[model samples]
Target: MTAAFVAGVGMTKFEKPGKREWDYPDMARESGTAALADAGLEYGQVEAAYVGYVYGDSTAGQRAVYELGLTGIPVVNVNNNCSTGSTALYLATQAVRSGQVDVALALGFEKMLPGALAAGYEDRESPLLRHLLALAELEEFAMPAAPYMFGAAGREHMRRFGSTPEQFARIAEKNHRHSAANPYAQFQDIYSLEQIQAAPMIYDPLTKLQCSPPSEGSAAAIVVSERFLDANGLRDRAVEIVGQSMVTDLASTFEAKSAITLVGADMSATAARQVYAQAGITPDQIDVIELHDCFSTNELLTYEALGLCEEGQGSTLVDADATTFGGQVVVNPSGGLISKGHPLGATGLAQCAELTWQLRGTAGDRQVQGATLALQHNIGLGGAAVVTAYRPAS
Candidate 1:
């Protein structure tokens, strides 16, 4: 396969559901316009498009992209739970890498309702049936599915690893502080650790502030093959996707009898390992990262899963402050889902856009100094984790 480069990326400022006056199509148009402008290309140049959203009717992709242009390009609608955005990106990158298309567009958006996320269809079988069963086997549901599952994982971490509620609260504190510099973040106000800890608890270790709110936003990225980059003089502006992989749940997801594994830590580990092997680099070589942090506990669990530390040692890393701006690898410099907002379909591509900006040295105040290699991890509990490694185009 040939190399696929992120020629350009863009996203709307994430907002609370009712806070925005626009809809998905409006978000799509604004984001698509920015991406095209950043790429210095027309919508007509896109040979195929992959659009993602979790809450929308069929053919919403076409409706979204029609606002960009009626180019009649192939528009594949994608939904892989919360990882939907990166799922689209994975397919777009594959299209370019396979020489099926010189330039493909990856777009994702979500205009979610306010309040705790609930099932959209109660009449049908839930996609999370197996996951729910796994949760039942471990403990009773304490909160909504998201908080309950992730909080259980965190509770298990505390039991086994000697991690603390204070440690998890610190993750939220760091991310909120990081978001203060990010204009695109939905919640940019920094909160102290005590302030975060004081917030009402949703599920034990996870306070209300540590949970990602239902958000409204969109993000897009233009993936191009090397030939297109060379033909369009795009090297200086492009960021190469050095390696990428998408993995699903394994037997360990259930059989391990571990909430951490049940919540997709193993899948994340597998995906990260595949990405590292593809990039021929170790976790220590990564200068920055943007991983799924729907809850602060997941962030700590992911540290071990990504090989940044050994299992049960995530709190140690947290104590060392190794994953923040002045530390070894700056994790979630864009504030992550906790503070950046998690609009399901938009989260992964938002991660991509932030990392691309980091690679190009354009992330401004939240930028990690001398960043060269970056990693992105986006996962959905129904079982999908997309991991991508990136570097500036040569």
Candidate 2:
């Protein structure tokens, strides 16, 4: 297979919904131009483009790319809910790896409404109705399905492994502390565990600070075949895509009647297993990670799903400070969705940008020391989870 590498990446600062007067196209232009400049390439060099956004019309990709140039290259629009960004990245990588395109651009941007996520299409059949039905069978449905699903998962973890809400609070606290060093983060203000726990509750055991807010942002990356990299003298600056996998809901999602299963934990584990096997490395080898932390609960559940710790023992990792700087692994050095903000469509590519910067040793104060290997996990319930591993080109 042809190897693909990320030659350049850029992202606009994640902002609260309506915080900026700009629109999605404006954000996309800023990030896309920055990425091209970073790669020292022009729009014409890109053979194809994959754009991801959740709340946009059919041709949002074309409109956004038009800001960069009128090259008339293939511009594919993509939407995979919260995983949309990474899904776009996955498609671009595959296109390059298949020798279908020597150079491709993967871009993601979002201009979300201010509040918790809600179903966009109500009149038509809801895609998540089945998942919601399964949840209703196990526990009463909570409004704003996101926090409810993940919070239920947290409650299950507590019941099974004796994990405390305070431990979950610690996860939020740690991510906020990490975000303090990240200029691009949406919420960089530091918070103590007490403050996190005491914040207004959004869902049971999930405080407002612990939940990723509705955000607006854009991110872009230039992916190239090794041949293209060599031709352009970009090998020294490229970050190689070592392994990647995307998994969706399995039968266990509904059959288990477990909050963890319903929230896509099994899918995450499967995707991580695939990535580790393909890369010939385990979770222990990853120096940095940016997993889906739409809420602190999911972050804890993901610790076990990603093999960072044993199942049901995510709190132990938090208690030991193992998932922070100077520990077992520096998880979410970019502050994650919780503190950095989660702009559904932009999230996955934002993770791509952060990991790319980390591998290149260019993440300023948020840099993870000696970060040679990085892992990213992005998921969209209803549902899909994409896990990818990256390393600096040798």
Misplaced by over 4 Å in model 2 are: none
- Kindly provide the TM-score of model 1 when superposed on the true structure, using C-alpha atoms: 0.99
Local error of candidate 1 at residue 369 (angstroms): 0.9
Candidate 2 global Cα RMSD = 0.8
Q: Write the per-residue lDDT of candidate 2 for residues 15-78, one digit (tens) a residue.
A: 9888789998999999999899989999999999999999999999999989999988999999
- Pairs in clash, predicted candidate 2: none
Colliding pairs, model 1: none
Q: Estimate each model's TM-score.
A: 0.99, 0.99
Per-residue error for 50 in candidate 1, Å, reads 0.3
Q: For residue 23, what is the lDDT in candidate 2?
A: 94
